[model samples]
Target: MTVASKDVGMMTMIENGNEVKRTCCSSNSGCGSSEILVEYAGNEKWIQGVINTPKGVVPVVSTQLNFSDILGSWKARWGVNRMNYKINPGLYAVGTPDNESPVLVTANYKSTFDSLRKELADINTWILVLDTKGINVWCAAGKGTFGTKELLTRISCTKLHEIVTQRTLILPQLGAPGLSAHEASRQTGFQVVYGPVRAKDIKEFIRRDMTATPEMRTVKFTTYDRLVLTPIELVEAIKVSIIAFGILFLLNLIVTIPFGLDDFYAYVGALIIGCVITPVLLPWIPGRAFAWKGWLLGFIWAVVVNLINGWPQLPSYSLVRAIGYLLVLSSISSFYAMNFTGASTYTSSSGVIKEMKIAVPIIIITVSLGMLLILLNSFMGI
Candidate 1:
């Protein structure tokens, strides 16, 4: 089949193959075409079959997610090879879409793609998947992977013009940062329409003649939303704790003392305060800066630990240990909480950089002093 539209061109040859590809011609040629090959057991779970289009046969996807999809999403949340959780980027059909069907665009991240398709269960539409290196739409947009260049290149490579009669493509509202709608239209002859902020609101947005309601446009970071982000943080913190435990063990050996269970519990408590407590109580915690919030909780926790260990009634070394724990645990918690800015909607790039400039130096100084105190007390009996 020969496909041509606007400035796009393509030729499809259906044969025994496991996947579809849209290869671009050399830039030196001053033109390019999409080459599609459909039929692959590898994508059988998501791909139901194929629908014959005027340009070629497009792989059809089920709108309902299966058990594997749910499990994969869970694994990704826990940071299990999350970066590898992506699909091959290309054009896909949701239901039996025709040329006049509404075309939606999304990233190649499997979870993001799944979220969109599951919401489109009853809608006949075309999904244009962009390669975003396994990142979600918002992050990819910020990183420029889901920008105007990739959008135009994908449009040409997929010969999207020939596949659909409509000259409009709907993109997620969150992806607006990296792309220029006018530039895309000027280059590819397709109008870009931004949809709702959430995939769940997409059906309603489309039903209302593609007009997004105010609620659909507002991005909310609710308790549940913030809660879901903690799993990965918790998992990563645990991994770091293992290495930290090893380092602590070596340090204790150097000081000729056994690594105490109280010290272990204290450190673990700091990790929990940073990775779990701080995020859960984010808004309620009396601070605008996440580092300050975490440090407050960590300081409180250190005092409680010292009180329980009877450090106040013990020797001067015990007092030094209390002070050391306070500084070190608070610093650790602050560092982790600062890193959470990347996952938060409350922080901007400039704001985070400014906060880091002030916080990082303080954290480093406190941690160094704390470690020095602990080591000196152990080594010199001070």
Candidate 2:
């Protein structure tokens, strides 16, 4: 278990703590004693330490309270209701582990870490948490906070190699894009093992010796999963939707005093249709692209408005006004729906960009034309 001296890199303390500037045996090598020179603010201090090699010294600061303990504090601070703003991002340890347990890595976002640990009630494992700055695994990985450099740094700082007997680290599959498996192995003696896409499947993955089948690796945005996301989307968009609705409703009142109520209600309904219903029914809607699906849902909303308002029975001028309203509503609804595609696991970056390129112009045209027609009708008193 002796790590060759040549394999050891320079020891540097990254934080505000005292710097230790001496090379010692690799913590993994089971060396019983090593000398550490502590330097801080141009002051030098030396201490001859007898550290148990292979079983690294666990810093008091590195150890974390159980996830359940943290969750209890979270509940007291932010009620029982769940929301994005309530989440705290930091490192967390999942499952109990003595010095020899396998280290499983994850982000510090409470919700994400909770999801990981809650699913592994019976297993005893060591969890190494990375600071993801409050983001989930997928997005954090894309942002580079969850990348290879950070992983290596954290491992070094924690002295993870010495803490565990096995030279293996388990990482989430979603983080693969940010990590270079080969480089990580070369830099740190720990071999990287990617686990399943969801934390719930981790037990099985561990039981199977860190191998994930195709089903476990693939991310699925099932109906239930999509629906769960709807609350956050709706809650976040509510304020904007209300302001937009108010402006549109006021414009409707100014344009047609008699039909103002109908116009206001139609626009409001469209906002809800686009931001709420469309997200909930995203999968069942027609097209592969989220924009198209939104558009289809918008069309249905327009049809509902037309049927309810008796468009055919109205004067030709009124009928034109109604069509104008419907067109604008549909466009706005569809546009917002397209934005929700970002939240989906299925939509790739390329696909979202392609859809936006085509959809933006179409939305602008429809909404602009609809608004112009309403103004024209109002001016001419049609």
Candidate 3:
């Protein structure tokens, strides 16, 4: 049984292309459509309606994303409201699904949920959302928020046994790291089925008796995939750049060190190389370690900076300052490039740790020495 819902509040919000008002109403079976109108008219608007069942009322959601959903996703990509961008972690209905419908599990991250549902435009399925603390499936799985414990607890809380007749729960393949299939099945009486790495393949996966092709299972981190993630990394790098720039500016005011346009250009160039260039050219870069790739590019950029300033030929230029520029630029680029380890699937946790052990000390020593040389050059006329 289902009750159609209408927008009762005067609050203006855009859905699809048209402006519409939204209202908050609990999907509990006790409340009628009329009673819901006057109960509580606040500003929560994600759920469209409800489907009453033997267990409880499951909130119905649209497969199509609205204007607000689109805006929120864009804001999240830029690191704005990133942690807060999530839906309520619970069972939801897409289209008019029955107890026999397949259950697809995913994280509560709004972007992940949006990606899953948008591809299910023609499919009628029940979505089981796990509380991943606004993290995507792959990350949350690594962090353990989307682990076996959370899955068992959510299944019990949602009374999934009563809501659906199926004994299988389809989970994203990336989330496999955290969940032990046998353990979850033992605890919840539901077998786990691993789905495709990408959400777009969900339709085909389901159409083929819940089996995924080899292509569907394969995870590809293409250039476009790496490119989209750069914005957030760049945004974080910019914050650090502001602090570094201020410190350099203060040094110029207090000391005789020549910190000017050349220095600023070199810093920004290194920042870009680390946060954007390294990721975009990841496959083509000569080294296995991201830090090494970034350092090489940053070193080249530092050379360009020196060339622009007419190094060696210029009588006033100090070799100490020139060497310092190379070290600082390369180190800064290496640090930022290492930050991409969390965002990429190319490196394992152990590999990242090993790289850090070898790279971090060198970076610290070189940067410290570089800064000392830059300051020492001012005093000794090196």
Candidate 4:
């Protein structure tokens, strides 16, 4: 069959103990053909051909590579610190696709492909990888890079029409913003079918014949999901934590009597309690705002400190100093907890900004007043 330059051609041939011969010749050749031969083993089901180009001849795979192997190789090459090499975003074939196999569409990002394949073990499907420039589908769709135009262009470039018999292509639900379903069908013969929001749900979605219920479309931020993000947050917060703790410790040492190691530890503990623990346990801490939750946790920490350190029973000046430290620590912790909303998916950007504006001033005022009161109490010998 003669395939168009913009078409990807799929052919099935049967051979009986002899190699099938074929030739490819460009129109530029005076003989009207460049002599090339395709040797198909008698048992071989398919053969791939590549047209030499300026850069190099690119290999065209007739059979799909194992999805797990593809994903594993990608992770090995690009996982942790190898961020320099940009991922290739374009059409890729997954599994051994026959003319009738289901076509699954995905973003070009290696990570996104890995996620989809890793979750879809034992499933025989064709993956039509779209060029999204290394971004996930949700973000790419929002940026319009994964929009209808690219989809149509890719379909033409890959000659997907020649490979699959069906006229349907499965896309991720999050990509709906950038795709015009009606326009896609008009531009390309293929009709668009939006899949589930998450790749993990694809198996079940396919079982249900590509129909996504409301539950499949919804995005949830459960505690476990939130907790998975904590490590990154902790790593990012380390620099700020160090500077804040150093300043607070110095203040504690200078304002109080002979500098003690215990005082330094207490100040450090307050920093962690406020910045880390408070944010994680935010919802259960009895307040709608993160600052209030931090304050509540801080108050509890103070009570525990008073009991353990016997600070309440200390001399008047020392008791006052202890109270000052606890109050300031609590205020700081609560304030930092409020910053967590920015990283949370559940919190809107506007809501986070609003919380920060209101909470920051309260934290500053309370911590400042607590420090000032302690100094005055020390001077008055109260």
Alpha-carbon runs more than 4 Å astray in model 4: 1-86, 107-111, 128-165, 176-190, 245-283, 315-320, 367-382
Give candidate 3's total backbone clashes: 0
| Winner of 1 and 4 under TM-score | 1
**lDDT for each residue of candidate 4 in 105-146, tens digit (9 for 90 to 100):** 887665566677666666656666666766678767877978
For model 4, what is the alpha-carbon lDDT of residue 214?
96
| Tens digits of per-residue lDDT for model 2, 1-382 | 3212211234344323754333223443231122211111222111112233343322111223365546643553333433232122212233446666667788755567656766766666766766565556887798887888768766765566656778888899999888888888788788988889998899999889789999999998877776666655566566677786677666666664334566667766776676678877877776787777777777778777877777677643476677786678788788878888877888788989999899999999998998877766775665
TM-score against truth, every candidate: 0.89, 0.75, 0.87, 0.63
Model 3 / residue 264 / CA error / Å: 1.0
Clashing pairs in 3: none
Q: Worst ten-residue run, lDDT, model 2? A: 37-46
State each model's CA lDDT, in order.
0.80, 0.64, 0.80, 0.61
Q: Could you tell me which residue pairs clash in candidate 1?
A: none
- Cα distance off (Å), candidate 4, residue 88: 2.6
Candidate 4 worst ten-residue window by lDDT = 30-39
Which has the higher TM-score value, candidate number 1 or candidate number 2? 1
- What candidate 1 gets wrong by more than 4 Å, as runs, is 1-34, 37-43, 313-317
RMSD of 2: 9.7
